[model samples]
Target chain A: MQHSDYVELTSTRLNPHVDPALTVWGWEVPVYLFMGGLVAGLLFLYSVVVLLRREERYPTVAKTVPLLATPLLGIGLFFLFLDLEFKAHVFRFYTSFQFYSPMSWGSWILLVVFGVGGVQFLYTLAELEPFRKTAIGKWSVWGLFKKISGNTRRKLAWWTLILGIALGIYTGLLLASLTARPMWNSALVGPMFLISGLSAGTALTMLLARARAERDILVRFDLLLVFMELAVILMWVGAMAHGSEAGLEAAHQILGGAYTAVFWSLVVVAGLIVPAVLEVQSLRGKWPHTVVAPALILVGGLVLRLVMVQAGQSFGYGA
Target chain B: MTRTAHKYGMVVDTIACVGCSACTLACRSENEVPEGLSRRWVNQETRGSFPDLKMKIWSESCQHCENAPCVKNCPTGASFIDDFTGTVQVERDLCTGCKACMASCPYDARYIHPTGYVDKCTLCHHRITGGLETACETVCPTSAIVVGDLNDPGSEISQLLRKRKFEQRRTAAGTRPKFFLLV
Candidate 1:
């Protein structure tokens, strides 16, 4: 295989050099992150309603959540499945537990969330004493499960809360674990995703709350979460700016570079700040009951995920 | 009798390169790598003023890092450094095509196959298992690329690595890369 003479190059076009992985992961990943956050956030709220015994005051959220949370989680898992290049090998995610990989943490957390969330949904159904004695309930194990009583439900609610928090943080840690992408390298990313998840969850529940008191309370909490979300985003950027060049490079793209316009206008202004102003006006009775703010919050949460993934990929750490 | 542990590594003599693309051809043919993607690539980086122009050739691929961020970051055990030779290898059947390893690697060495698995330079593990040198190292026209077990004091790579000044790729990334560019 040795050649003594210098070999001459022919065509350079055959092996064209390209930038490394600025577009490796695309839209599907962000969508999955958003949905996962939403599920975690929603279930956390559901746990609050059940464990805190606030179900009487927020019956709309309490009743609907058991039904809503699991399916939303399923949809999020579906998006995760869609992103996998090996669709048939989806079962591999469950085959082992890898502590080093954040993706491993996510798979296990997501499964636990689904399991606890599904059980909670069933328990909520069985708790209905009137429905349990009915023909529909006795058709299956619902009648026997109805005898499970309040103690099991409480245990499940506690499990749900723990797993919910894990799942929420895992969404951000998933990307933050990628040290190669300096944009995502931060200890604060988990809290950032958690706060966003809370805000998005509040907004999602507000959309379904039919009671006057429930909507009003959610609006107040949603506004608080939105404020916290904005603050965390600023803190994240500031911390990155103070530390390393790679972080700054990533921060530059998101804060002032190619993504500046869309991120600020679509994500910050229309999605967050404007909606916050609208929510404040409604709280002061300047405007009537409206879905605009809550809707905007959800959109902003999704934009956060999308922008992070896109700009983070565009950023780099190696030559 | 047991096979002795070997930390196989490579040193590329950048000064001797002729931009031949011969190593790339050898890698492709040996590994049966798909088109439009490669386990290795050649790039040119030019520096200095117009009057003192100089160009450097970078035949880039997986660094086969000692710490191996890709191995740690891979959810499955598919991307692992071989226990016998201590060179990285991928289990194609075990890979789920999640691209976690690909994203985690700083070198950008891995790519997804059409059948939905990640592939990257293994330093020709198939041939090395039978006591053969890597195809790229064997076919180099200028004898620019050298490979051997760094742990063995008698090996060619160790001797070259000790006498020559070399720079590692992305050493600051904390990956502790094994691939070296002999200056």
Candidate 2:
């Protein structure tokens, strides 16, 4: 007689959120990553504008955006803090640093970004007419701000640019370094995330820029960033597809697996392609400029992080 | 010549295990593992058809790898290798509870303790350091579980490996796991 053979597991290994699948990270992490990317993009754009001596040409990019960096980063850090299981012990991140830990590198990099970005904000504030008329702006620090010449601003810009790039890459490296999640195992994720951030930053700048020339320049730059983002994303998925069994499974998750519809609809079509087409139309003088395109890019940027973070955690070694 | 330090590990005889889960209970009691969580558990696998069927049962827990990804990924030096015994251990106070170690572990061996720290099988570090066997090894009715120093030639685990054909879980992960399962 023929019989069926089966394997059964019976034990008390009931660890919540970890047994059947890893669900340790939730929405908090993606939100934190999104905000971090946004700040990184803003800082990078601000630094580039200053370094190229385009402050006169792109005043909003050079002045207004840097002021947003410190507050945006603070929001991101708050969400990161919320994700920590031990909230009181959060300060321990700074006490000792593990060289191999991407989180460690990210934490330290965030601190440096904050310091540099804060200084840049102060300089920007000192130069603003509305702020200069305020009481606090009349402080003796105004003397130091006045002493900051074009050369010092350029040096600061260089530092901000390097730090911004580091921060942007670090956001992606944070997930890429975790080899346990096969979905994030590719080396291309860092550059992909960096490009995505740059695209988001460009979109935000385009929305905020008052001058048509600034908007035109950002529209073209964002178009290039969006294309780069799509290419890197494709390369990442292709690399995963060609990787190990688990890697293939990870690739399948986004390609045609559970995340297929959302990844394609929300992230790819609406977030990237739609925004690209809109920007292209604007460039051609066929579509009137509005907040819709840049707004979509920002939304897409957030959805990308949300999808990647959730999908990466859902599958691993055995899955 | 300098003497190599003791590398504590475990060996389980799959054929000898009866799947009673005594080891799992013993571990929970010994480690005081929190509710709804366990440091160790039993798994039963049955394969083949009818008269040709074969069944194997074994207990599982942290592999305590020599190249543990959890230790490497911990940002705060919280997850670390115990110097006295070459086994992985977590410094509870140092852990920020970031869960990076949780995501990095291929074995899924760690869990965030209810008290806001990452906890896992220390191989009964307290008992082993006191010159006693792990609670699971001590309480296993079939004597299927063996815990000892892999570095010591005369140790039970070393002799078992020498005399028996064995396999490890997910060697492809390149973690160099110390947990062994005798075939």
In candidate 2, list every pair of residues with a backbone clash. Answer: none
Q: Which window of 10 residues has the lowest lDDT sum in candidate 1 chain B?
A: B45-54
Best by DockQ: 2
Candidate topping TM-score: 2
**lDDT of each residue in A76-119, candidate 1, tens digit only:** 77877787888888778788777788898888887788778887
The residue-by-residue lDDT of candidate 2 on A14-90, one tens digit each, is: 68978777899999999988888888889889888988889889988987898888888998899999999999899
User: What lDDT score is found at residue A4 in candidate 2?
Assistant: 62
Cα lDDT, model 1, residue B166? 90
Candidate 1 wrongly placed segments (more than 4 Å): A1-21, A126-138, B1-4
lDDT values for all models: 0.80, 0.87
TM-score of each: 0.92, 0.95
